[model samples]
Target: MTDPVDLFVIGGGVNGAGIARDAAGRGLSVILCEKDDLAQGTSSRSGKLVHGGLRYLEYYEFRLVREALIEREVLLNAAPHIIWPMRFVLPHSPDDRPAWLVRLGLFFYDHLGGRRKLPGTRTLDLRRDPEGAPIKDAYSKGFEYSDCWVDDARLVVLNAVDAAARGAEVLTRTACVSARRDGGLWRIEMRDGATGAMRTVTARALVNAAGPWVTDIIGRVTGTNSARNVRLVKGSHLIVQKFWDGPQAYLVQNTDKRVIFINPYEDDKALIGTTDIPYDGAPEKVVADEDEIAYLLAAVNRYFKVQLRSDDVLESFSGVRPLYDDGQGNPSAVTRDYVFDLDTGGGGEGGDGAPLLNVFGGKITTFRKLAEHALDRLGGRFPAMGNAWTSGAPLPGGDLPGADVPAFLNTLRTEYPWLPRKLAGHYTRLYGTRTREILGNAADLGDLGRQFGPLLFEAEAKFLRRTEWATCAEDVLRRRTKHALHMTKAERAAFADWFDNAAASHRREAAS
Candidate 1:
């Protein structure tokens, strides 16, 4: 029999990948199994902001707000390539929230987290400042605060990469079918989603970071009962052509007191979204319904001078937030905080059985802290493990000197003088220090191989496949990168066909 590993994590979302990285860095042998692609669920489909959750202040979730606010700078320093500061313009509406109340909330948001690098809040004259150009003239007052934007899917993949680099096994597109506790250890059976191959491993501890599927894993996969439950709250977003000028994003208040974010996305497009509604369906099947789209458009039109319609929406996505159910009647009122349920034994007395740590309810901003707290919960189980270190460590491709993105971008332009300015910016923003790996030996654009679309080349695709665990065209187009948004329908289809044929040929050659 093989030796038992220290930790076995189930899920590939931000939280799961974060935990795996933390555990692996702490010198514990770990294996992470995800049923699908990394961050294919709720993690990638978030508001994509690392903010303090200003609305939660009304609900008195001070702790969550404080931690998240602090995390913004922490993540910014760690991965400056993919995460950076963005100012948000919150147009004050007398009917929704009083100006004084909004100011008070911003005050708490500014001071709650010991903020340093991000600028503090300042009042805005909506009629005068350029940020108010898109806002209706009626809104004369506004508040501008700072938050950070993130590529949520890439964040998960980078953590997985770092974990793998630290000697942990990250298995994507693999499902953990069954986990049973045997002789004070967890025997887990996992099947590959692609090949139907099955494998088993034993671990001293198990972590369930399945996001929306947390309860399903506990109830169906592990057959264990938990006193806690996850509340399913559906949130949706829309991608449309960029309607506003400037890099600043808008945060508009709806009549129901909900806030909608209209942020600039992909340079030429806008990302708007997020409605809170109680969901009772499968997480995987969640999609933006017509009502949700109308609701988002209506909310944006209500505040902005530039009206938006359903036709403006180029793409849309929805995800179910598996919040820790606090019995809140309103789905929006549910806590964004996380809760840890530590089952020290498999229905055994005392400490005679293996440990199973079930994580519930966390946001992207606080994933690192969540991972630290998770390991803290297992301190008793792994006393010899290393101390917490992720806060100061950079993820893969994020080690830009001084965490300065613009400086690094300039360096990239100087080094790759033959590269187009837009292409250089894309590579610098996405890959940071690792751009050289994709640009290797290529003196000009032609060396990048076949050009599938604007900015995307065969060399980048090959690099993604070789290094980032990209297995399919969708993995490259949708998750690993946002090339799908730039490519036409025919272009995307052609690329998919080419990728399929090339991958098949490579596999056959390798086998022979």
Candidate 2:
């Protein structure tokens, strides 16, 4: 059967979802297929920042630095609820780079891209400044710079949601198993991972955006070859209770010339991470090894007065970055910029044919621009498509009056006075203007239905299922929300059981 879509995108990571959203908005019929749930890959497992690679200044990545730096504020305005400006405290290590160089980098970072709303960098006297209280007394000097924090997984979901809202099809738990050029169109077969069912789709073009699985999709799934290669760099993060005061994050420079981020997470906890190690194994089986965790904890312990121990680790996760192999031997030195390989039908398709664009190596901060550039790469195919419109558009509920989130939160506090303070704040921070849709006409706590745990109320679960396409309990607890991190093990199990039964019963009723 002939396919109806103009584009068939493989993967539901940020890059795929963003591309699908951009293409769909440009008047192209699009269908995005993910092997697992949205952000069940590296997209969710990021450092969760939208910053210009501050350290990349050393590598002379001026282009990447400027683009990403500009994207920081653009994304903050686009999704105020999921992305926000953050200040980072970098304690001076005279043993490492000199203070003059650090100041120079910070100066470039401050003025690189039109930074209008976010604050500029400032030097600190660690011995006197309140920001230096948490650091060890050994360090008496530091610098503070600005970046933006992001809900990485939610960023993917918002793109997919906006794509769907613009009439694009987003099929989670669907894997593109095969692709072949048939006539001028591309034939793609997708398998539903949950049901063992298969379906075929036809599209004018196909996009490979499987992140760590990009090369896998190109060779194993698409049965095509490219001169380019993907280097799988394994990175990991550890979560623990917040050990420091204030909202400011810490960027600690390692003796290895690498930097580790210690950022506040989920209100009461801190998110620390990332070791760059080359990996030859499967991406799905990647996990944080003892050495990696020890390394991270050691890095933090080196800078902070309060040393982090193995016992402090509440959780940990690992991801493989599908970096485009530029023949760089060092994993840390590999380029983070993406490369697009378009196959215009040279092999078994006879001579010339439909385009197959394969995206490689990108960061969460640059996904939007990456998507726009991906479409620009396909400009030859669809010259009639609309111009770039995403730079100014808000994602989902980010369209607050004047983009003023503080004012909006104040208004929400007055409107939902009956709601518990923590719960109300959580809803305001996560849902933004869409909080009303979830709360609806609820009068009190009783109107919210059964409360499974501290914050996993039935009302929120129902909203997730109905609006966010959350079918499984883990999707709601882990990705759609962070309730799993806060909920007890027993609480999580009970909520899982409740969600499973509710979904099954609802489906049964719908069929009847």
Candidate 3:
């Protein structure tokens, strides 16, 4: 019989990946299994902001707001290439929320988290300020505040990469079918989704960070019941051609008291989102309905001078938030704070029994702290585990000098003078100090192999497959990188065909 590992993590979203990395760095043996691609679930479908939930302050969730606000800077420092500061311009609507009340919320947002690098909020004159240029002339006041933006999907992949580097096994497209406690350990059975092959492992502890599938995992997979429930709230976003100018994003209030964000996306597009409706359908099947799209467009049309119709939408996506049910009837009011349920198999102090930790309700902004707290909860079981160290640690390729991205970009341009300006910028932004790994010994564009699209190259795809666990074309085009957004439909289809053939040949070679 094989010896039991220290921790077995289920799910590949931010929380699960974060926990796996944290535990592995703490010198604990760990295995993480994801039923699908990393961040294919809610992690990648987020609003993509690392702000302190300014709206949560109105609900008096001071604690959650403060923690998220502090995390903004921590994450920015850790991965300056993928995460950076952005200013949000909130157009004041006196009918929805008073200016003084909005001012009060901004004050708390600025001061609550010991904010440093990010600038504080400033009042804007809608009639004069450039930020207010897109707003209707009827609006005369606005507020611009600081927040951070993130490449959400890449964050999960980087965490998994860091975990693997620290000696944790990361199995993507693998499902944990069953977990049973045997002889004070968990006998976990997992099946590969690609191949009909099953494998088993014994673990001293189990962690359920399955996001939307949290309850399903606990009841069906682990064969255990939890009193806590996950409230599935669906939020949707629309990708349209960017209508407004400037690097700043716009936040407008709606008649229903909800707020809508029109943010810049992919350099030439806009990402407008998000409705909080109670969802009962399968989490994976969630999509933006006609009403939600109309609602978002209406909200934007009310604030901005430019009118957007349904035809303007180029793409849309949705995700289900598995919030910890706090008996809140309104989906919007549900807490984003995470809760942990520890089951010690009815064992008392110092007893010989395995532990199961089920995580519920967390956001990308607080994932690092959530992992630290989760590990701290298990400190009693693993007395020899290393102390917390991730706060100061850099993930994968984030080790730029002083976390200065522009300086690093300049250095990359100097070294790779043969690369195109746009391609160089793309590599520098996406890979940071690790761009060299993809560039390798390539002296020019011809050495980088086939060009699938404008910015999609053979070397980048090969690097993702070899190092980042990319198996399918969608994994590379959609999640690993946003190259699909740039490529035309025909171009994407051609790339997919080429990628599949290449992957099959590589697999055949390995089999021999």
Candidate 4:
């Protein structure tokens, strides 16, 4: 066992990592444990957009939409490299929401939450505008709005990195087998996935930000009960080649009244998704079904001149959103807003017992705020804890001058003339100013070690494993970085083989 800390966070997703970072920065001791790699779950498998959820306005979630809209600019200012503005062209459908209603929503979207830095919504002429060229002429009008694109997986990793830098213990591939309250402190037991070794930790309070497994942690792990419940909603997406010519993305309303986003992804590809379905299966076992794939393709086909078929789906992924059950029957109707269930001793905040904070239904755009609110709930326990500090601070590597990505990229290239333009661009997008840490003093491409693909290099892999807690090949290929999406099957297999060997050798050396 070890000395008791101020907080113990159970999940390593965005919310959990964000909470860990926030608490640690507040002068509170914290330990954050994850069963798998950071963002190995729903955090990585998102539509990769940080938006205000324009459709939510129809549900009268003005507070949620306004908060999200405000956060959109805050996050973009915070992480300019990974989170930057993107234009979305919404092709109007006469059959669905009327043009007047659409215009009203855009008006509210522009004015709500004090919009700043991003362009306001504009009307598009589908018959003449360049953005509408890809649309079938049947739709003669559309609207364009601004939102931000994000590297969903990298966002989670950066939070974990910042938490560690702030003196918080981040354990990846380590599962919290059990956590129970004992004598006013919570005793937590964790088992390492690789060694099967168990370690005990005691914390003054616990946070169950377990995402899909929130209830599991409450009942099965902590042996406690809660009145709250989470409704599992499955959302799926498909990846295809960028079929049109433009930086702008497309938003089309389907016959079912749900909006589909077809966004430009990875320069040469497109990311189209997300089907909302009531999910009852295991969150880990979730996968995009054929029906969902067809549905997404059909939605795109309805507006675009380019015909998309099921075969055009290069990849598909699904994430089970643990939405707070709001007595809504439709999966899409469920509120994306978050809720907190704090369990202090005897159901009161002033009690001296260790508190367990359970987070429900939070999205990427509002993670920072969620963390601040979560900590505020436990202010009675720690009077000496510092005030909320994440809103003004930049995340790891997010401290760019003027939050300018283009200028930073140019500067990086000027400093390292040997770095290829594409490689430099990738490094800047993923690591921002921290690209120096990955490149080091080595002056040329040869110094980057072996080249796995155009973007995947041996030095970058080592950096991830060393600093970012990358345990296996997928951690780098899929989450910490997205080199897997660009490489061939054989190349991926070869890299995996090399990575496994390297990891085994490192283990042997450590044991010696």
Per-model TM-score, in order, reads: 0.98, 0.98, 0.99, 0.99
Tens digits of per-residue lDDT for model 1, 1-512: 46899999999999999999999999999999999988889988998888889999999999899999888889999999999899999999999889999999999999999999999999999889998898999999999999999999999999999999999998989999999999889999999998899999999999999999999999898888899999999999999999988999989999999999999999999999899999999999999999999999999999988888998999999989999999999998999999999887645324657989999998999999999999998988888999999999998889999998889888988888898989988988888899999998899999999999998999999998878888789989998899999999999998998888888887798899
**lDDT value, candidate 1, whole model:** 0.92
Model 2 lDDT tens row, 1-512: 65468888999999999999999999999999998889988988999898999988888888999999888888998999889888999998998989899999999988888889988999999999999999999999999988999999889998999999998998988878899988888888889887889998888889999998888898998888989988999999999999988999999999998999999999899999899999999898999999999999999999899987899999999998999898988888899988999888884323357889999999999999999999998877787888888999999888888888888888877887798878877887778898899888888999999998888799999998887778899899888888999889999999999999999998899889
lDDT at 480 for candidate 1? 83
> Over 4 Å off in model 2, which ranges?
347-352
Ranking by TM-score: 4, 3, 1, 2
The residue-by-residue lDDT of candidate 3 on 1-512, one tens digit each, is 46899999999999999999999999999999999999999999999888788889978999999999988899998888889899999999889999999999999999999999999999999999999998999999999999988889999999999999999999999999999999889999999998869998999999999999999999998888788888999999999999888999988889988888888988999999889999999998999999999999999999989999999999999999999999999888899999998878766434567889999999999999999999998888899999999999988879999999888888887888899988987887788888999998889999899998999999999999988889899999988899998999999999899889999999999999
Candidate 3 weakest ten by summed lDDT: 344-353
Task: Kindly list the per-residue Cα lDDT of model 4 for residues 16-43, writing each as its tens digit.
Answer: 9999999999999999999999998889
Q: Which stretches of candidate 4 lie over 4 Å from their true place?
A: none
Clashes of each: 0, 1, 0, 0
After superposition, the stretches of candidate 1 with alpha carbons farther than 4 Å from their true spots are: 346-350
Clashing pairs in 3: none
Model 4 clash pairs? none
Model 1 vs. true fold: TM: 0.98
- By TM-score, how accurate is candidate 2? 0.98
RMSD of 1: 1.2
